[model samples]
Target: MLKDLSPQAFFMGLLTAFVGFASSFAVVLQGLKGVGASDAQAASGLMALSISMGLCAIVLSFSTRLPVSIAWSTPGAALLVSAGAAVGGFNAAVGAFIVCAILIVIAGLFKPLGRAVAAIPAPLANAMLAGVLVGLCYAPVKAVSFNPAFGLPIVLAWLVVGAWKRLYAVPAALIAFAGVLAFGVDIPEGAFASWAQSLGPTVLLVKPEFHLASIVSIGLPLFIVTMASQNIPGIAVLKVNQYEPNPGPLFATTGLFSLFSAPFGGHAVNLAAITAAMCAGEDAHPDPARRYWAAVIAGIGYVVFGLLAGAVTGFVALAPPVLIQAVAGLALVGAFSGSAFAALKEPETREAAAVTFIVTASGVTFAGISGAFWGLLAGGLAMGLARVARR
Candidate 1:
């Protein structure tokens, strides 16, 4: 297996891990805080998610010999941010997360459920994912308006690198973001010592407290959004790249990992959608057969990044939130573009796709559930009506 390793694959793996962490890990941290996680609990969540997904990726890649990337559910995290606090606070939210995980596992183990998940119309799923990305994708333009000096450089870096090679664009923007942070702002000489000291994850646990409200609102919707938005798109990406790993086992393994992680304040973990392209695509390696190394290396990278989760939190705390957001936004544009294209690619699904995208982007809240859920519901309803009208 190691014989397949190449320099191209190695750096690509490194790049994948770098972009993956820098893109939305901050959002993950914020999501934990929204659920009323104490600072320590939030740290524990980051560490747990990082380690869990890392191990998941490593094992899946090696076992299946496929680049089966795993990631914390970004949309689910967003859902937690919106409704978790309202649904009985942190412990209840933890229970909701566990419930979501368990549901994912059941969905995996049960063939009919697996078929049902797979049966979700691709357009609606794409539209829902696009909607989720819209808020994030707009961040760069928003950031530049807020701070041209800081944000413009990142934008320019992204544009230039994107023109050269699309895959490298986000990483280039990240470097530019870091450069701006490093030189544009002054750092105390002594703080470096403090920064050094705060590396590696600290363990903390939240005892879960389940409630019907939390289950109906946060758990069910979280599972639906994660499956619809992340896993479905993830499988599509792998298929496009000529890799087809079994879906049932993928879902089951990630769900189990997520279940294990919940008590430690981690949210959902699942098949990766966006960064899956980075590791699975031709850019990761010339020989498609050997791309598994990229994912394996990425797994190692995620673990290493997990060790620095504490430091990453501190670094984000030090920077302007808008700046971090700007960088994060830069990273997600590619995903938004792909999802949007997929949503609207077919003429028949256009109306339903538009409905999904608008509702999701609107961020409307009702019945203690998030717009991602409502968006999909609205889109599906629209689709059904359109079919009836046709009949």
Candidate 2:
């Protein structure tokens, strides 16, 4: 079945995995801060999430006979970074995880929330997505300015693959990486060569401690952000790709996974958009029935990468900052354009979408929650009120 797919499809899947992994490296630091995790504990969290996501993707793909990619909730990480700082360190963050898990479980059982979100107008959803992705595009351009030597190669690679659309799925990230090596980018001296580093490592695990203050301060906000920012768009991605897996099961699985890993400082887990798109694309497998393997492959790769957390961290540390920025920026360009275009498509909704985009892009925060949540709420409410007045 894998052999039957075009090379482009397989390469696309590989690219998807690479991008997902690379983009997520920054979150490790945030995750550590949220949980007050020791280096080993942090590594464990990374490993566990990767393994869970990979296993879930593999099982779901095989069971559903459709390509399905599962990924750690990126928005969840961002939410944690903001809210975790205020909470009582890692323990409080774990408490929030527990709350989010329970909420997800309840959401799965109820079905109404999922149904309503699914009912959202495509244009509105797209506008919200555009707003979400706009900030991401700036990273790469910024990276290039910071480190021209490293960033240039990544940009060149992007241009090369972009120009030759036939090589679109050829893991442009790998090419960029090659450019990094070819350019002789230097790493900071003695970054990790310290006696503090222990060779024989004991896996550290965290126990969830519930506190009222922490739950209100951290848990509630994280839960709201994860649902509003991540899961809603995740469902939209699945729908847009025309793969209608049962939302209940998907939500339930992610919730359960989060529940299991929360004590160890893992954040919310959910579907991936960009990575999933790779698997869902016609390039992966013309016969959609077989495309699930691509996700399965990606999931497995995620686990492998996760286990190498130390190595991953070291590599990212050595990587020129400009390169990171450039890669992130390039990757987000399509997403940003698609989102902005969607946000303005409807005359009636244009004003609301614009409001959402501006507010979200402005990066405002109230009580630890990000502008993305408020922007969507503000826009959605305005649209709803306007419709009501029309009636």
Top of the candidates by TM-score: 1
TM-score of each: 0.87, 0.75
Please give the lDDT score for candidate 1.
Answer: 0.82
Residues 123-173 of candidate 1 have per-residue lDDT tens digits of 988888778767766778887898898889989999999999876787788
Show the lowest summed lDDT stretch of 10 residues, model 1: 78-87
Clashes of 1: 0
Most accurate candidate by lDDT: 1
Q: Which stretches of candidate 1 lie over 4 Å from their true place?
A: 1-12, 78-84, 186-196, 240-244, 277-291
Clashing pairs in 2: 9-283, 9-284, 35-90, 130-339, 139-325, 140-325, 140-326, 140-329, 143-322
